[model samples]
Target: MSTPAVRIADLLEDVPTASNPPAPLPAPDPGEAPRTGGSTLNITVVWGDLTEVAADLHVTGHYQSVVPAAAELALDQAISGGSRLIIKEHTKLGWIDAQLGEVTYFPCKAGPVRSAAVVGMGPMGTLTERRALQMYASLLGEAVALGHVESMATVLIGSGTGNLAVSQAARALVRGFAGVLALLSPPTPPPRLTEVLIVEVDRLRAEQLHLALITAAESLPQLRIAPRLREESGGRLSAPSAAVYALAALARLAGPQSTPTRDGPAGTATRDGMPEGPDRPGREEALRTVLAGFDPDIQGKVREQLAHLATVDRTDLSLAVGGSVGEYDDSAQVRMSVLSGVGGLRWAALTGRATVPERLVPVDMDLLRELVNRLTEPSVEDARELPDLLSRVVVPPDFQRLLTDDARVLLELDRDTASVPWEFLAEIQHADGGRHDPLAIRTQLSRQLRTPYARVMTDALGDAPLRALVIGDPGDPEKGFQLEEARSEALAVAARLKNLGVEVSLFVGAANSREPGVDPARRLDVLRALLSGRHHIVHYCGHSDFDFSGTGRRSGWVFADGLLTAQELALLERPPLIVVANACYSALLGSATGLGRQAQPSGAADRSPWGNPQAALVPSLADEFLRLGVGHYIGAAWRIPDKQAISFAEQFYTYVFEGGPGEPAPTVGGGVRRARKGLYEQYAAGRVPPDIAPNPKRWSSWAAYQHYGDASDVLVRHDSSGTTGGS
Candidate 1:
C-alpha cells in the first residue's frame, strides 16, 4: 500500500538493520504459565519520532481542541496534498467526531507512515493514565482485528497534555499492550503485529521510559525488547512528529483469578453497577452509632431528618455512570439498581444507553458529563434544540414507571451522575407546549458520597446558631486576578447571618487591619486556627483547584502560598455541620477508580505521610467533608460566575436562616431547591444584575449546585428557641 507522495515498501526498505539486537524474551519459570493455553504479546520501547517509525499503523493522542504541532508539521510536510493550514483545519474539524477514545483513521498523503489513527483523550483534568491504557488497548485490539496492522506506534497519550510523568505514562502504555495480548489469546494464529515502538520526545525522558518498560517486561515473557535512538544527535531522539509503536510481547501470568458471577449470591452483583453486600456498613450501623453519641435534643432532630429520608414508600434507586470504548461503540453506559421494600426487598439491575452528538462534543466532562454538556452550553443556533438534547437521556421505561407512584423515589446518584443537573431533564412534553424539568415533579435527589456517619455531626450541630468560617478571595493576589465580588459576597453573607442572630467569623483578602495575623501569606495557618473553633458552616468564596500535580487525591482552594488540600482539612478535630465550597469546579468528583485523585482519609492505607494521599475512590472536596464526618455539603459542579454564585448563596442562606413571616425555616434540601428556583425566576423576570444577566442561558449555573448528604438535615440555633436553619 502506497500513498500518492510515497511508496510504503520503499519507506520500510530505507531504514538499515540495527547493529545490535534487543534482549531476548525470557521464559516463564516452571509452573508460572497458566494451564489455560493462550498466546502472549510482544512489546518494545524505542526512541524516535512517530513519523519516522516504520510501522503499518500510527496512534496519535489529542486533547479536545489541541493537536500536537510538531506531529502535525511532519504529516503536513510528508503529504503531497495538504498545506499546514489544511492539516490543522482537518484536525480541528475531525474532533467533532470523537468524544473520547474513539479512533479516527486518516491515510497519509506523504510521510513514511502508511496510515494514522487519532485517539481522542477528552481533557487533561479528567484523563487518568488508567483510562488512557484502557482506550489504547481497545484501539490496538480494533487495529489487529481489522487485519491491517503488522506493527503500530502510539504517542505517549497523556505525557504532554495531561502532565503525566514519563515513568507513569510508560507504565500505562505497557499495561495496555499487555492487556491486548492477554485478550487476543488462543490457537487462532496471533495478530500479525510483532513489533511495538514506544515513542517519546526527549532522549533523557526516553531513556527513563525505556527503563520503565524494561521493568514492566519482567512479567511479560512473549517478546524481546530494545531501545532505538536517533544516530545524528549522539544517541538522542528528536523528530518533528508524534511517535507510536506496538507490543510484540504479551504476558499470561498463571495465577488464581476470581470471577464473581452475576447470580452467585444474594449479596453478589455483576459489574452492572448494582449495589452489593447488604448495603455498606457505613450506611447503617456505623451511622446509627454516630447518631447515638449526639446530645438528646440535637439527636432527636437528626433522627427526624433520617426518618424523613426513610419515609420513602417507593423504590430506592442508585444510578452509576460508566463508559467504555467498545470494540464498536463510543458512548456512555448507565447502570442502575432499583431497591424496593414495597415488593419485599426486590432489586433489579438496569442498563441504558446515551449517545453523544458529533457536533459540540464534550471537551471537558463535569457531570452526566457527556449527556449534560450537550444540553447546558449550546450555541445560539442550537438554543431551540434544548428539549431534543434533554430527551437524549431517555430513562428506561421500567424506571419511568417506578417514578409514576407518589412514593417519592429516592435517587442516589454517584459523583458522575450527581454532576448532571437531573432537575432540568425533560422526561416528557407538556400540554402547555413546553417540557417540565423532571425534578419539578418527582424524585428526591441527594448524592451518595459512599460514606455515612450521621452520629458524628449531631452533637456538634446541637442547637447551635450557625457559626460560619467565611473566607473570600483565597486565590493568590499578586499573581492571580482578584475576585472582586468575593469580599462583598462574604460580607453580605456575614451580615445576613448576623441579622439572623448567627455568629460570623469573616476573613476577606488581607486588607483587614482589624484582624492581626490574618494575612494572605498565612492562608492555611489562619484557616486551621479559625476551623479549630466551634463553627457549623465554612463558606469559601474564591477559586478552587481542578488539577492535581503531585500524589494523592487532592484538590483545594488556591491560597497565596499553595493549595489547601483535603489533608489540611483532616486536621479539624470536629467537623462542621455543613460546608459550602462556592468556587469553580469545587464539587467535581475525583477518579472513579477505588483510589481517587482527590483526598484520602487520615488512617486510610493509601495515605502518604509526606505528600497528599492517593485519593479515595470518591475524591471530591465535598466527599472530603463527608469523610471528615460533616453532615451536609453544597458545591458548584462546574465553573460558575461570581454574581450567580453570590446571588444563589445569599438567597440560599436567607431561606435557611431567616424565612419569611409565615413560612417555616427551610430544610437544607429545601433551601437549595428554592435558591435554584429563585435564581431561575430572577433570570426570567430580568432582575439579575446586568454584568451577568444578558445571557439567560447563564442561569443554568443554578442547576450546577449539588448537595452531598442528607438533604433533610438543618442547622439549629443554639438559643432556647432552637430554630433550625441553613448552615
Candidate 2:
C-alpha cells in the first residue's frame, strides 16, 4: 500500500485512525469562541490561511490565538448567508468529551451509491496561491467519482499559510471557484516584492490554465460550461497538462465572490496594472506582511490538501469549488477549476464503463464509524449499553444545534473556532419580521457564520446587489402573495441594510407545489453564504412539509438518496441564527432516513422537536426541522391563508430589526422565543387561531412529547433569561 513519499494507504485513510501528533490546539476560551479578539483564530494563519478576506468583517482563523474586538466583523461565507457559531463538543483525550447520546446517528445501510460532486478545489492550506492550480487535479479526480453535479458554485478562502501571495491566491481561486480566473492585485507589495504578483499570476495563470483545461475538456465527453473554451485548443495546459490536483487547488485557494450571478466573473488589467492596497492606508502593508510571510508549513499543507483532492470521487455533470473561505470566489471558480483540472480525464458520464482506481477504496469508513457510534449510543432515557461511563454524555443545547447543521459544524470545527459568532446565536430573532426583505438581515447574520465554513461563504459575493429567491414567478406578479407586499418589504429592508452599507442580491424558487427539482443540498452553498454573516434572514413561504411516515408519502420530495436527517440537523455543526420556512406543511426532514428517527430538537421535551406527542406523526415536518437543527424557524401548523402568512412574516421581521444600525437581534433565543411564545399562547387560547388546524400535541405540555438529551445539553438556547420548558 505504500506508494511514494505520501503512502497510498496513508493518503486514502480517514481521520479516525489517521491520527497525527497534533500539537495541542487548545480550544478558545468559552466566551472567546464568539469574540474576534482574545480568541484563537491566529494559529490557522499557519495551518491554513484565507487569502482574500474582509479583515474588518472577518476574524482570520489562526491555529493559536484570536484578537478581541467589540464590534467584530461578521463571517463572510456561511450557510443561509452569513456565519454563526456551531458549538460541537470537542473533547480531546484529556480535554473534551463527545456526548455520544447528545448527537444524532443516522441509519447505516449499504444503500445505492450516488455520484459525488466535484467541487474542483478549495483546498485550504499553508500552500501558495499556485496550489489552486494543483487542486484542480484532485477536484477533477472527484468529478470522476461523482459523475456530475446538478449545479455548483464557489467561495473564497484566502491563503495566509503557504507560499501563496494574495494575488496568487486570487488566480488559483478564479480557476478554482468560478472557472473564471482573473488578475487581481495584492493589498500591497510583499514586503520584498514591489510588484503586485497577482498581475503576473492572473493572466499567465488564466492562459496557462485555459490551455490545460481545454485539453482536459477534449478528453471529457461533456463540460460544466459553454463549449467555447473546451472547443478550442482542444484542452491542454501545456504539451503536458497542468496537474488536475493543481487546478483543483487553484479552485480551493481562490477567493470566490459569493453573489448569485448570471454572468461569470472576467477580469482585465485596468489602465494601472492592478489595484493593490486597501482603501485604508497603513494597514495594507501589515496585512500584506502577514499574507506573504506566513508560516512555511502552510505550503506543505496545501500540498496535502491537493493530494487529498486526488482521492475524492469526481462527477462530470457536477462542478464544485473546493477550498477554504476567502480562497474561492464563487460558483465560477468551482466550475472552471473542474474544466481546467480534470474535465478532460473525467468520464463523460456516470453511466459508461467508468474507470475504477486500481485500489479497492471504501467510502469514508471513519466518518461512517463515527456515524454508527453516535447513532447506536444508548438513548438518554433508555440505557441498555454494556458500560455506564460511555453512555451518551449530556451537552448544552448550543452544542447539540451545531451537530445538526452543516454551517454550524464548520464554524465550530474549522480553525476560526474563536471567531465563531456567539452574538448571532443570541440574537437569532427578528422582532416584527414580516414579508420585508428578510434576506438583508439574514445575509448580515450569515456574514458572521461564513468566516470558517469551507472558507467564507460570502467571500465570493463581492460588492453586488443582493440576490433573492422567492417561490413565486417574477413575471406573473398576481396570483402570488409575493408581489408588492414581499417586494416592497424586500426593498425597505434592503434600504436599511444599505444604511449599514452591505452588498446583497436575491433569488427565489418557483412556487411549485412540489419540492421536485429543488435540491435542498444545493441550499448548502447558499446557506454557507448566509452562515458567513452576510445575509441576516432567509424568509420563504413555500408549500412543503416533512413526510414523517418514513414512507415518504409526500410527493416531490427532492433529496439525494443519501441525505442528512433531522436528527443530524439537530446537531448544527455551525448554527445559523435565523432560518424562516413560511409555507404550508413545510418542515425539515431527514434526507438520510426520510424521517427524523434519530435526531432531536434544540430544546426540552415540550420544546423538543423530534417526534410529536402523537407517535403517528413521528416524521412530522416540525420534528424534522428540530432534528435538522434549524436555529429559528416559523412554519404553519398546517395550511394557512397565504395573505395572512405573508402578513405574519412581515410583522415578525419588523420586530427583529428594531435594533439600530449594525445592531442585530440578540442570539440568546430572545426574539425567537419571545415571539413564538405569543404564537403558542394565542394558538393555545383559541383566540387567534388561523385557518390552519392545530394538532392535539400543540396543546399538551411542551414537554409532553419530550425526550431527554445528555444531562449537560443538546440545544442552542443561549444565555437568555427566557421561559424554559420540557424535561
TM-scores for candidates 1 onward, in order? 0.43, 0.24
Give the least accurate 10-residue stretch of model 1, judged by summed lDDT. 244-253
Taken over the whole model, the C-alpha lDDT of each candidate is 0.49, 0.26
Highest lDDT scorer: 1
- lDDT per residue for candidate 1 within 1-727, as digits (tens), equals 0001112331232221121111121112222331222455555655556677777787766544432334443444444242223334454334323334556666576556778766665532344455555555656666777685777776566665454555666666666656566655665778887766666645445655666667655666554466443322112422211121000000000101222322255355522233334444434564566667678898677656544533321112122322221111111112222221221212222111111111222222222334445444333233334544453433443444333212222334433333344545444454577633344223334454433422232234456455777887755455553576776676677777777777777776744322343344247555665457578878877766543445643556655555566667666667787778766542222332212434544344323221212111223566656667676778765555677777788877877765555554345665676677666666555576676656655656655666665444444565646654333
lDDT score of residue 196 within candidate 2? 12
Which candidate leads the pack in TM-score? 1
Candidate 2, residues 268-378, lDDT tens digits: the string is 222213322223334334334434755778855654664454334211112322222211111011000000012111101000001112211123333322322322212
